[model samples]
Target: MTVDIENLIDGESKFVSFSEKISLPDAYSVNGDVLVKLSGKISNEKKGLFHFSGNIVAVLNLNCDLCLKPFNFKLDFPVNELFSRSIHKKDDCLSFSGNIINLEPVILDNILVNMPMKAVCSNNCKGLCEICGHNLNESDCRCEKEHINPKFEKLKALFEESENE
Candidate 1:
């Protein structure tokens, strides 16, 4: 929701309330989803100063980084911030004034900052077999020989040459 500065010029306080479903398209590096229930309160305190606080709850459906399987997760976050009319000239932080505040960017930033960098299906996720692309968590593949690094072969050859010399 957008807050108009004109309505807040006189130090009058108001609330920006929402209980709608919001979507996070790029929830993960590959494919992931987050549906949030958002509700918040915002108030104008003084000239160029505002207070924003709220609660957000989300259900996340994402692929496990190791197992490559879908996992359901939950996230709960409390939102609180201050927007001042005077900008800090030397800092990267933002300044707000003239009674206008657009909340979409703020919400998005909070969500992205709090998201998990890596999520696994379980603590002991077996992950996929590198040799055959088989999910080791479910079943094992008969391919015993694993892929070896070409760099290792070169090192081995160097060691043999040194031994012969």
Candidate 2:
């Protein structure tokens, strides 16, 4: 949505509404899907300021770090932003250009900020089997469970010899 600064020049207050399907770049493109639903309410108080608050909903196709399996995850978050034409901007204020204020960047910024630190399919995800490269969440593996890999056997022996010395 674009807000016209001229509308508030006549001492008139206005509210602009927006609801649309927007697309984000492939920065997070594991499955090449980054479309989202963006909806918001922007209001001008006629005091040379605009307040924008909204929510973003998107289904993220992410790979589970442990299992390495692709899964569909729902991501939703709220956005609170302030836009103004004043030269004296607040700490979190964004400045607009000319007589128009574009909202595309604002919405994308909020979505990036609200992204999860980690993506996991479940709390107790069994992850992948190391020996057979199988997804443990789906099936069980007969491979013996060892904390240390056999490749590090020499390092373990050296450390054990040092302990005896």
Candidate 3:
């Protein structure tokens, strides 16, 4: 959703609340769509700068990286930003013009940053077996495994000889 920033241009501090429901496009490769709620206030600071701060809440459905199972997760983050007349960096500060503020990129970037790198369906997931690629968490497989490296067998024999001695 496109947010209009013209109202914030006025020389008055106002409370503006907006809620947006967006679906992750196919490009994102997300398992399911998510609902995002954003509400905040915009105020004009000294000079032609504006400040937008608020809270963003969202729920996402993603697949566990380990188990490949789907799970729902919640995200709650606070939004804080400073705008100035021109984009400049002095010491440690951000500035933007008061006439126009594009919030789409900011919102999207924040949400993406908060996403978990490794999502899990449960705390303990057995995951898949290496032998036959079977989902061990679902069921047990009886496939006989073979060890190709003969050096490993020699090491096992050494351990067995030591135990016997």
Among all candidates shown, the one with the greatest TM-score: 2
lDDT of model 1, residue 139: 88
Clashing pairs in 2: none
Reference-based lDDT, each prediction: 0.71, 0.73, 0.70
Work out the TM-score per prediction.
0.64, 0.71, 0.66
lDDT of 1: 0.71
Separate clash counts for every candidate: 2, 0, 3
The parts of candidate 3 lying over 4 Å away from their true place are 1-11, 23-33, 87-100, 143-165
Per-residue alpha-carbon lDDT of candidate 3 for residues 1-165, written as tens digits (9 for 90 to 100): 443466654566766565666766553336445677888877777566677788878777777777677767788999886666654644333544445566656667678888778787677887777788887789988876575588988998999999999
Distance (Å) between predicted and true CA of 103, model 2?
A: 2.0
Instruction: Kindly report which residue stretches of model 1 are placed more than 4 angstroms away from their true locations once superposed.
Output: 3-16, 23-33, 85-93, 96-100, 145-165
Worst 10-residue stretch by lDDT in candidate 1? 27-36
Cα lDDT for residue 21, candidate 3? 65
**Each candidate: RMSD to true structure?**
8.3, 7.6, 6.2
Q: Which structure among the candidates has the greatest lDDT?
A: 2
